[model samples]
Target: MKKVVLTTSLLAIAAAAQAQSSVTLYGRIDNGIQYENGSPQGHKIAAESGDWGCSWFGMQGSEDIGGGTAVIFQLEGQLNTQNGTSSGALFGRHATVGLTNENYGTFKLGNLGAGELQQDSWALDPQLMQRYAISTLTHGRNWPGIANGFEYTSPKWFGLTLKGQYDLSNNTNWNSGVLPAGQGRSDAIEAIYATGPLEVRVIYDELRSTQGNFNNLYAASRSIMGGGTYTLGPVKLWAGYQHLNAPQASDASVFGTDAVSAANLPGGVSAPTSADHEWGGAAWQVTPAATITGAVYHTNVNHGNGNATMYTLAATYNLSKRTFLYTEAAYLHNSSTSNIDLGNDSWGPNNYNGANNTTSGAGANNPDYGHSMTGVFAGIMTAF
Candidate 1:
């Protein structure tokens, strides 16, 4: 009888412990067919993954330790669902451990998500920062993952909250120049306010080059972003503006410009020293499970690099709470000296077969300089 009573007591204790700890496995997969025209290689159709969103899986867990505190951790990675391929590195998306308290707020360290700028901008992007939206013109600058990162979040007070994030170089020389290409220290600060049907956010961030300078406007630079949203019943509106500057690249760099023909000076193209980007759009919930959005994005490059504009329309129909079908159509117009691609930035010379031209390295989808581009995509996405 004593043994039987002891066994029952042990089971009770185990059940109580289980109730205090929880874990969840979650993921999403997206795939689609895409069509585009305007590249020098001609029009083409292709199967694509991560066009509308990324395909990734993750596990998150938390244990309540009492006193309004908890220990938490997350592990996440990305994969190409179309071909069953991994996106390199296990847990490339996130590998983080943190702590949270009701009064002290939350803290995390490790490979966190993108910096505060990207996180804060998501709330104001009408297209949800899809492949063919805000990121297209900026060359995916807003979508990079953070490594060796530390982050902190403040508790909401009077509908206002704040966040800060820092990404370390992990090198002996702090923010060291000459470490390697694309290796630099970065940091950002963000503020957000939400009340009733209105929300707004502002973020400031900067990335240093391998030379410890803002040498590449599109790659290593400083940025200021301000945006917000307003919701009225079934409709929501979004608008934002961003300023980017790279004073160190007043001359030319590898990502700068080169002669497109013998008539022009060789290796004499000047890179953009500053730029202004703006976007605005609205989303309408036409039905309980259907949404449609339209938005315009524009970029003005300094130093006569010219400007470009993109117009896009997207629609989604939900078959279930966890599954949806989506489609988008877009058109991009580039000025005589500008060459911006649709969907994703090529991040290289815009001209075709120009001096030291390396558009092939980026992809064959880059259009010729002073040209236009059009694209359409249809895809299905599901979350589990």
Candidate 2:
């Protein structure tokens, strides 16, 4: 009887080991060719789609514990296929570990995407193959850094959830008379949400930076976004809205434009400023394999600075579950007489020029007139 009991105990241990949990490796490689136009100088054609999709690979794992508890972890990194270099910082995309319990909630640490952003992932414009694809340049806002941070997500209650994150700057030194080295440098947030056929999300962020003595800048940014998609057989329709506010501007000369300094202060002085932005869009599925999307984005800056309006349209055709072709274009108009131009910095040149070639005296060296951006992309993506 004792020998039989020992054998049974060994078998039970083996079974527990097998049932603990597992890890898996996964990733996607998306590439394509693109042609862009509307430069102040003219138009040019280069590599269409090399680093656009920003191909990447990652690993994820979870371990099951008794009584509905488990530990989970994910380490993802971006890859620049064009030149075969590290995406940026280590685990620039995401690096996180956490725990979850069916009867409780979840807690995570390390670099991770905001749950507020993920809430709308499913309702994004369908015409765009990759919403943030470097080549397309016609989709959502980009916040790439996943620095040191921690997050908590509550268990869903009646199809609703809550989540938040805090990022540490880890800086200790501050310039004399400044807000302090890490005063507003760290990233912090709070968010709330609900889901189902319709979903809503609200996110608040704090950003801070210090200049020289007697000069510092701090801003509180907040976004309220909501959208939903309802499917009717094989077709679905979706729409969303986002509102953003930046209440504090930089006072350092190095951070302000020559134009703003000269016009807003004495002897080209600098002070704090504010800005607000609103964005909305819609998407429609023309067929099971094709989609069309449209969006309008508007920005209003304080101090008679100026405003900008952008309209975008795009279409995508899925050749298969893993392959697709897409095209997108955008037209932006700087309507503010303040000569303030806020152009897209992710793709080409930075800064916006005024209508009459009046330099806003902004960062680097901005021209007088702001131009438009139009692009077309034809490529394929594969995932495994």
Candidate 3:
């Protein structure tokens, strides 16, 4: 009898303990087909994944530690649903553990979303900087998440919230002079205001590295961005601007507007004089189940590279609360001396950069620079 009573008591305690914490599993799967023209390799058509937002699977949970405090954790990873592969990181997208307090705010450690992505770019852009048309057209392409990161998010006060992030180069004492991961460190600070129908944001981010695994010797990149949104009637309007500067460094080349990966500038070259970007867009909720959005993006690259512009129109139809169908078409214009992705980052087969260059086609991957590219894709997405 005593054993039975003890068992019942322990089971009750277990149930109570479980009630203090909860873990939920969630994810989104997105896939689509795309068509493009004016790539280095000419025209193409194929299926694509993550063209909207990267597909992902993740779990988040929190345990109440005590009064007004909780311990929180999240594990999220990218999924290539079409290829059945990972986004290359075990938890490449997000891997974090943190503490949250109702009044104190939240602090997190480990890999997390970068500043431009979490703080600035997403807030100002209508597309949330996805792999779509506007994303390619904007200078936010440099936005990225980082490893060895720390982030702080402050609670809102008077409609204002502040966030900061630091990425440790993880070098031994931030080793200098062309060391692996010589970027030393990166940082960003952002402020956001939200109330009723108005939202505003300001952000500053920078990167410093020498041996940043780029074709040219690494230097530093800095950016300042500001933007806002207003809600009026059934239409939501957004506008924003970004400026980027990459100066030439001793014994190193300047960074390009597109990318500096081992693939972009194999032999390395001088960076451009400067780059400027501007954009504006609006979303109209035409019905309870549908929305139409359009945006125009432009960029000017100095050093005689000329100008690039992109126009995109997209629509979404909701089949249910958790599922939606979307279609979008984009037109990108590249001056004879300038080549920018019409699909944003890289659409089409061949990839290109700068003004009027061509490269081998990667089947259906990014398009080369120096050519105008146009593309359209329709896809379905679901969240669970």
Candidate 4:
């Protein structure tokens, strides 16, 4: 009888301990079929792993420390669902530990999701923030993330929230000797608001080369952007703009010019200078489990680069709360001096081997100026 009593007492203690902590595992798998036109090698079709959010799995846990405070940790990784392979990164997506306060906010250290830039994009895009569709066309794919740094997110104040992040060089040799190739600092600041049917955001992000190179060529890049969304019933509207600039290249870095050739560039045959981008979109919740999306994006670069424009439309039908079937179409039209491809988010010829000129180990391909691209894709996604 005494032993039974002791066992019950120990079990009660274990249950209490478990109540103070919790962990969850989550994942998503997406796959689809895609086709594109205007490829340098001609038309093509293929199956792809997809949805704007890459296929990934993650685990997160939290421990309550009393006093409205808790400790949190997460580990996530991207994977290719088509063939069951890692995205070449063990935990390429995230590996973070942080602290959260009920009234104060949250702070994190390690590889993070950066600022609120990505969340802001969802409001300003109708395609559910597809990476290659609306967002990439307007904003260059330069989210460095917090590789070796910290992030802070403030508690919401009347629908307003603030987030900031800094990426540091993990190296120890700083003031004494030569710096590493990518050993510079990257940082971002963002502000966001969400109130009933309205949402808004502003963000600033920058990266600087540590080499102290000359001629501003690939020396640094910066982005300043603002946008918001408004919803009326089942329909949501979005609008936003961004300004981006990269310093000019020097004589020693003239080879960098080859990276941005006539085919891919707006006008300048050299490295990127400054560019302006604008975008808008609409999302219609046609039914309780179905949605339609459409968006338009445009960009103009200095140095005779001219401009480029892209249009995208898509639809999603939910099989259940955790699964869906989707179809989408996209088109890209470039000015006489600009070369931008379309259907990048979907897959196939349009993005991989379009009309751009590229060599082995060369920079990304550029579509031929004045050329047009179009594509369509169908896919499904499931979350667990």
Candidate 5:
């Protein structure tokens, strides 16, 4: 009898300890077919992934460690559902370990996302940063991942919370340059305020290139964004503005020595120093499971780089709690000197920078300068 009682006590203790820890695996898969016109190579049709949203799998867990604090960890990776390939590394999306407390807040270390810059901007973006939304105009500068990062998120006080992140280049030269592991040293800070039906956020972030310079207007630059959303019944309104600057990108050298040519450069200038981007839109929940959204995004690039505007409409219908069908249509108009395309970070065949004078059908992903482009997409997404 004594032996049995002792064994039972040990089993109960083990069970109690196990109850203090928990883990969860979650992910989303999105795949779709896309059709577009106006690339230098002409119209094309293809299957794509992560157009409406990124397809990724991840596991997050936490352990209660007494004193109103807990240890938390997350490992996430993005994959192209169409090709079964990962984005960069095995866990490139996120790999973090942290401690959280209700009173003190959360502190994390390791490879991480752009914190609230990415989190809050999604909510504020009219198109949720989709394939042809905000990221498209700025060449995907708005969404960046960080490695060797340290992050801190403060607890909500009233309706306001604060967060910040710093990524170390992990080199001896402080901000020497982009390393094989990640970009040069970077930092960002954000503030968020949420009330009954409205939320607002502001962020300031910057990334550096070789010799700690902002060499690429879209790749290595500084950006400040402010935006907000208001909820009214079944309709939500979104508006935001962002400014990007890369002072070091003053000449054709940033693009490359062979990048400059008569096709792209009219006066031998092939670099953009600054840009202003703005967008606004609204979403309406027509029914319990359907939503319709419309938005406009515009960008004005300086240095004769011209400007572009995009108008888009999208809809989503939920088939179940974890699955949905989505469709969207968009049109992008580029100025006489600009070659912005319809897809995110799409710079076209000239991908070199400046405008391309090529009218030939080639291996280009976007249209020629001064041309217009249109696109349509349909896809299905599921989360688990």
Candidate 6:
């Protein structure tokens, strides 16, 4: 009996030690019903969800290493609640590992969302309606692919924090056939400030891609964005501005050339030309469980020959902590010389193509397009 008691005690201690090396499993499940019109010249209604927050499962853990330092890691992936399929490439959202010290800062590595994403994430609009989530609009712009990278986040100082990230291209060439030397390299930098009821951020990103064609046409794109938010009583006001410039081949070597040519191909015979976008919104909490949000976004594209403007509005409502309903409507008023299009050939409909006049559809060949998109979504979300 003595020996058995001693063995049981040892096992207990081992279990406790293991528990100290904490690991947690967490996830959110969201789904709803949706209706869309003016999409590819059709009207449709279907079961939809993931507007407020994508359904996902994640595992995170931290191990104390003594000396006031710890090792941490997280792995997360998105899911499609309707079809029960993976959202995208495995581990598409986040896969990172790093270390933290009580007095120092934290450093992480892998494919992770940018600091700009955090700025957008804090918006109170999504709490009321998923349609008001800025993430739904920015999509690719928010999480530019960095391949392999590292990020550092400083400990908060007087309610202010600093973060920086660097991504290496592994020296891979994306323009072997398009451009003689190619420019398939990229980099990014960002800064942020937060205090009390105010928050602000600025970010700059550049990407160089080589065209796989004769004349070795190389494309280099750059974007700069700055924004801020202020809170007063039950009202929160937000504003932001972004500038994007992409110059492509004089001819049809790049993918965006079709739209460029269709628009009369301005900007001195280059691709993409230039685009400036400005947006702002306000969120009002009408009650504890319900909020009202409204935002307006405008984009001006200059391709030398012509220009165009696009505007959007979105709102949402939270029925409960784990459930919400939302709606979004957008209008693009193109000038006579402006050629605007829409489709979901890439990430999704949110990308918006000007030349085709097609919007992002739910699935491939879903035929949802043209002029405007009005969608109403109602869904429930549970977190664990």
Choose the strongest candidate by lDDT. 5
Query: Which stretch of 10 consecutive residues in model 3 shows the poorest summed lDDT?
Result: 346-355
Indicate the TM-score of model 2: 0.74
| Candidates ranked, most accurate by lDDT first | 5, 1, 3, 4, 6, 2
lDDT of 4 by residue, 312-375 (tens): 8888899999999988888888777655665432111223222244432231334555667778
149 in model 6: Cα distance from truth in Å?
A: 1.7
Cα-based TM-score, every candidate: 0.92, 0.74, 0.86, 0.86, 0.94, 0.77
Q: RMSD in angstroms, candidate 3?
A: 4.6
Report model 3's TM-score to 2 decimal places. Answer: 0.86
Query: Which candidate wins on TM-score?
Result: 5
Give the residue spans of candidate 6 off by over 4 A: 1-19, 113-139, 171-184, 210-220, 248-253, 256-270, 304-320, 329-332, 337-354, 357-370
Model 3, residue 27: what's the lDDT? 96
TM-score of 1: 0.92
The list of candidate 4 runs beyond 4 A from truth reads 113-120, 138-143, 172-183, 210-220, 248-254, 257-268, 343-365
lDDT of 3 at 238: 95
- Write the number of the candidate with greater TM-score, choosing between 2 and 4: 4
Ranking by TM-score: 5, 1, 4, 3, 6, 2
Residue 227 of model 5 has an lDDT of: 92
Of the pair 3 and 6, which is ahead by TM-score?
3
CA-RMSD of model 1: 3.0
Model 4, residue 97: distance off in Å is 0.4
Q: Please count the clashing residue pairs in each candidate, in the order shown.
A: 0, 9, 11, 7, 1, 26
Compared with the true structure, what per-residue lDDT tens digits does model 5 show for residues 63-85? Answer: 99999999999999889999999
For residues 1-384, could you state the per-residue lDDT of candidate 3 as single tens digits?
999999999999899879888999999999999888876566778898877777999999999888988999989888999999987676877788999997999998887743323335776888666555434753334454556778889999999999888777776655222321223466789899999999998888766544442222112556777889999999999999887665643222432333423244323323354568889999999999999999888888665556788888898899999999988888788665555665444211123343223333342333444457788888999999
